[model samples]
Target: MPFVDIRLAGNATREQKAAIVADVTRSLVERLGKPPAAVQVVISEVSTENYGAGGQLVADRAPVPKMGEDANAAVTSR
Candidate 1:
């Protein structure tokens, strides 16, 4: 039996959560040799403001000046 717990920032759509569960189950079954029915997975969503990174709360992360531009640059540079 395998139990997996995921804690992430809250606010996900129904389809998004379903895909997460499905992918996790598939990984456990294929990679760990666990039966689909034998693996247990739980997801706990918390407020982004409650989490912190780089000594600053998630809410404190400076908002990007332009949406998608920085993300595109990062992807292309890599």
Candidate 2:
């Protein structure tokens, strides 16, 4: 049996999780010759307050860049 564990900082949509599971199962079936039914995939969502990096919690980390914004323009406009 192949066991896969996925950890995320936030929740994902049902479609997203379905895609993940499909891709993971495909990979395991192809590479490890494992049956799809024998593969185990678990997705764990961790709260930002409970996750940390570089001595700071995820909730206190730097902000992410906005989607569809140019890096240079975003910086200059800030």
Worst 10 residues of 2 by lDDT: 69-78
Candidate with maximal lDDT:
2
lDDT tens digits, residue span 1-78, model 1: 999898876577878888899999999999989989998888888887998888988776655344647755644554
Q: Name the runs in model 1 displaced over 4 angstroms.
A: 63-78
Candidate-wise lDDT, in order: 0.80, 0.87
lDDT at position 77, candidate 2 = 63
* Shift in Å, residue 67, candidate 1: 11
Name the regions of candidate 2 deviating beyond 4 angstroms: 66-78
Residue 27, candidate 1: how far off, in angstroms?
0.8
The candidate that wins on TM-score is: 2
- How well does candidate 2 match the true structure in TM-score terms? 0.79
